[model samples]
Target chain A: MSAALEALQQRLGYRFQQASLLARALTHRSHGADHNERLEFLGDAVLNLTISRLLYDRFSGSDEGDLTRVRAHLVREESLHRVALALRLPEVLKLSEGEARGGGAQRPSILADATEALLGAVYLDGGDAAAHALVKQLFGELIDTTTIDNWRKDAKTELQELLQGKRLPVPSYRIVATHGQAHAQTFDVEAAVPALQLSSMGSGRSRRAAEQEAARQLLDKLRAPPAR
Target chain B: MSAALEALQQRLGYRFQQASLLARALTHRSHGADHNERLEFLGDAVLNLTISRLLYDRFSGSDEGDLTRVRAHLVREESLHRVALALRLPEVLKLSEGEARGGGAQRPSILADATEALLGAVYLDGGDAAAHALVKQLFGELIDTTTIDNWRKDAKTELQELLQGKRLPVPSYRIVATHGQAHAQTFDVEAAVPALQLSSMGSGRSRRAAEQEAARQLLDKLRAPPAR
Candidate 1:
């Protein structure tokens, strides 16, 4: 193994029985034909299950919705990227020259996918036991420190659930505009409920966030007392 | 033990060490506050991971997308409901008086959730070995019968993947209209690729199917030669 890979293995706390699997996990799609996409897919399932299991065991009093919310927060791209960064995955990532120049190694989505790929590799190299153990080890602190109370449903989800609970027609969101640079774009979104004759607008760095913001504003409007 | 519970265990092919878990798994939310929701949550993760592992091992040559598509088909509500029906789950299901009178046991969603809950109960009552074995046994035939070639990418997924591969902005789907009776609603969906200045229209019995049909039509347009 190369010095870099050896170091990465140390950080992962896993010695791959087949080092090739580890190598494949680190190879991004931008790098070549054979890459980490499949591994990332597998890793994603594993990560979800691991986190769900952990949450299930830890939060005995919590309902399924509570468990799902906490698990979602734990496994989102931001959280996965943080985990990847903690393992210094960017140092070991294999990217194409173009992607490398484009800072692919530092990209959150890339890092998150690679992290999942690594977990996939771990599962493949050592089976469920190893994969489960590694996930538990890596996420133990996060699980311990995190509380379900800290997880509020994102605006869109909250709105949808609320409407569903009340047997109200679902709200809709649409992107009204997109502008600025590709890397730093802004999206203007509108949230509407035709049944309620209400609409609210919000803008953010991404379409999802913008939609979420719109939902938040719309929810505010929904909850407000009527003006005199 | 009741004869009904015993027969249900016989059908499941595994007797629970903790009968209470089995009882809880059978209980529906409508039954009472203490229900199978938590178990269903845990079981969902277990089912996802189990199917993922199975697919990974079975389809060594399939791409991540293929694996994902197949897994989605395998673990969907319909498939889970089929599995539950095969086990004669309706005969063993526990529902509140109102739900029972409303035919809750025969409901696809309820049957599916109960199936997952049963798997969760098995995991809790036995452990990983037993859970894995049960899932393997339950899904083995279906896994053997289903072919990757038969699992075509749904229109929406195909469109999304194609756009992603081309580094183009993703398409957005909106429900333009929903008509007909509540029990037999028809949804009119529009799929738009704003960057491409293209849109397609489709209508179906459900919003998702309608959106998918619109996407399919759009893809056909994208893939065809320009009309004279």
Candidate 2:
């Protein structure tokens, strides 16, 4: 076994009888036939559930919305990817030569997927409790509300309520156009509500992003209270 | 505040400044205007995150998929509803007179929603940490793996893989007939792959269930070991 792999096992407090699962977990699709896609799928669900339960326990009197926001923050792709990197996951990751050369190890999506796949491998090898322990130990500190609450609110929810509080009709969004090919499409969205005509346009790789941008624009506009 | 509410607060190991939120959390939308829809939404997210984190910590070697299954078992609507009832959540629930007479307080959906809403109210009152503590206290015992392992696997997934493993064509499902009104439907379905055909009928509020029933029948057929 490679020294890096051995060190990783030590840090994670686990030793794999079948190291192949670990290898598969760390192998991204870009690495070729033996990839971590299935593991990633399983890990994603596991991560969400584990973190969710922790937050639920820690925040005794919290509302579901707040808990949702905190969970999102704790399990965000960026955060998971960061954890993966901290474990020196990149050093052990078996990627295609081209991908390794292209800095695939540093990619957020790849790192996040690999982390989840690693969790999957753990579960498969040792069972649910093992996976839960691994994830909790890594994320327990992050669950601190002081850090999570700092960035919980989303623009769309706030903007929607801002209008609704004023007895304004709920905003409606329309996809005006799409630019680019299927895998890389940029959407143009227009958000409108009859009571106030605020025309804002947003562009993103997906419709959701475009809508979020449009909402952000509306928020900026609405934040400026009308002049008397 | 009602004495039932006070007893519940003591059991939860927390006091509510705004007892109204707790009352609202226990009130289902089916009951009246002062229901727990918003709180339920918030609580659902919180529950997911907290559980996810805990599983992650407890199971260092486990992956996301196993963790997800475990969490799903822990937080399924039925499970949450049971927990809500165990906490005596229904006693203080404010319901429309008609719903109260109808025993709406004991309904599973209502109980589940109320549990989520209660989590939401707690989060709102005391923030994420507070909500986490409450959920953890209520559900800490659920983390036992032996209990989680006993959960039935989704029959659909099992049947899908069974066909795939044998290198047969992907199984296809067809709804042969439907009987009953729009509110509650009964369906007869057939699930077939090249070498095997299974048919079964089921009644549910939706079509997915009918298909699941058909898949379940197929599972039964495939249960017997094949000649080596």
C-alpha RMSD over true interface residues, each candidate: 10.9, 12.4
Q: Clashing residue pairs in candidate 1, if any?
A: none
List runs of model 2 lying over 4 Å from the truth: A145-148, A152-228, B1-228
Residues B182-206 of candidate 1 have per-residue lDDT tens digits of 9999999999999999999999999
DockQ of each: 0.21, 0.11
lDDT winner among the candidates? 1
RMSD of each: 15.3, 13.4
Candidate 2 structure quality by residue, lDDT tens digits, B119-218 = 8788778766787788888888777543433444666787888788988777787878888887766777777765665444444456787777777777
The C-alpha lDDT values of all candidates are: 0.89, 0.75
| Count of residue pairs whose backbone atoms collide, per candidate | 0, 88
Which 10-residue window in model 2 chain B sums to the lowest lDDT? B144-153
> Which CAPRI level is candidate 1?
incorrect
